[model samples]
Target: MHELSIATSIVDIAWEQARQQGGGRVTGVTLRIGRLSCVHEDALRSSFDLVTEGTPLAGASLAVIEVPVRIWCGPCNAEFELPGIQRFACPACGHLSGDIRAGRELDLESIQIAPDQIAADTPEAKQPEPS
Candidate 1:
């Protein structure tokens, strides 16, 4: 399934970010998935678990934030969220809108890592010497 590939990509990103921040094991990952993104949350979670095995994100929790589909109605000159995916009509003017403003996002928002895994010599952990 494509979800497997998506999960693999997420794991890769999280691992890279964690390492770049100083070689830490990810504890959690937050993703913003839009309704129009067509990504099933359950399937993605399952795939994440499978893909992260033996990796830095092995026991990391995956958190998904659902984003509603928003569209811009040319006739109404207004932006509103779609009540359902099937209906692309403007709620205020009842006119069909093809101008999608949002709801197609599949972004990795943030990642949490274990504190102990971070390098102590990093700039954030460094102490100033006496002048």
Candidate 2:
């Protein structure tokens, strides 16, 4: 499954980030996965566990934020969440729209390491000054 490769990449990224800090135990990882991303949650979770074995992120928890497909309805002049992917149609005006506003993301939101928090796309946390 492609999930394995995905998990591998996640591990690699988290590992590099963690290693940059202090190689501490990673507590959790947050990801934003969209419905249109075609990533199986169960498989990704399982693959994460398997890939993290014997690694620094061995016990890191994998959390996913499921994002629904949002389409921009031109006639309605608004964005609506598509209930189903069978067709991209506006719920209110019933107009077909191919303008996808969101829900095609597969991004690593944050990394929760030991005590310090590494916020999204931010640089490394500052280390404490020696006494």
Candidate 3:
């Protein structure tokens, strides 16, 4: 599925961000997906889980925010959300707006990361036994 590819890309982005920030574990990722973006949220989540396996984001979760379709009417000089996906006409003036202001967004909003923790096997993590 294409979601797998999208998931992989998301992991790549998160990994790059984490690396740039000096190496940390990703906790969550927030995405803004428009209704017209044609992405299946459930499938994307499942794909993300599958693609993150054995990666730094293995335990990371995805939060998807659905964005509604918004349009700008030229005749009425007004901006509003479409009543339905198929209806591109403005609700206020009933004018067909060819100017799409929003929606069709597939963007990564934010990424949540936890500070890197020292591994138990690391020398810095070893503790001396009490005398």
How many clashes does the backbone of model 1 have? 0
Candidate that beats the other on TM-score, 2 or 3, i.e. the better one: 3
lDDT of 3 by residue, 8-89 (tens): 9999999999899998878788899998888999999999999998887876778888899999988888789985789889
Question: After superposition, which runs of candidate 2 have C-alpha atoms over 4 Å from their true positions?
Answer: 115-131
lDDT of 1 at 6: 98
Two-way TM-score contest, 1 vs 2, winner: 1
Best by TM-score: 1
Superposed Cα deviation of residue 54, candidate 3 (Å): 1.2
How does candidate 3 fare on TM-score? 0.86
**What tens digits encode model 1's per-residue C-alpha lDDT throughout 37-100?**
9999999999999999887677677888899999998877889999899999999989988899
Which should have the higher lDDT, number 1 or number 3? Answer: 1
Give the C-alpha miss distance for residue 50 in model 2, angstroms. 0.7
> Would you list the clashing residue pairs of candidate 3?
none
TM-score of 1: 0.87
- Cα RMSD (angstroms) for every candidate in the order listed: 8.3, 8.6, 8.6
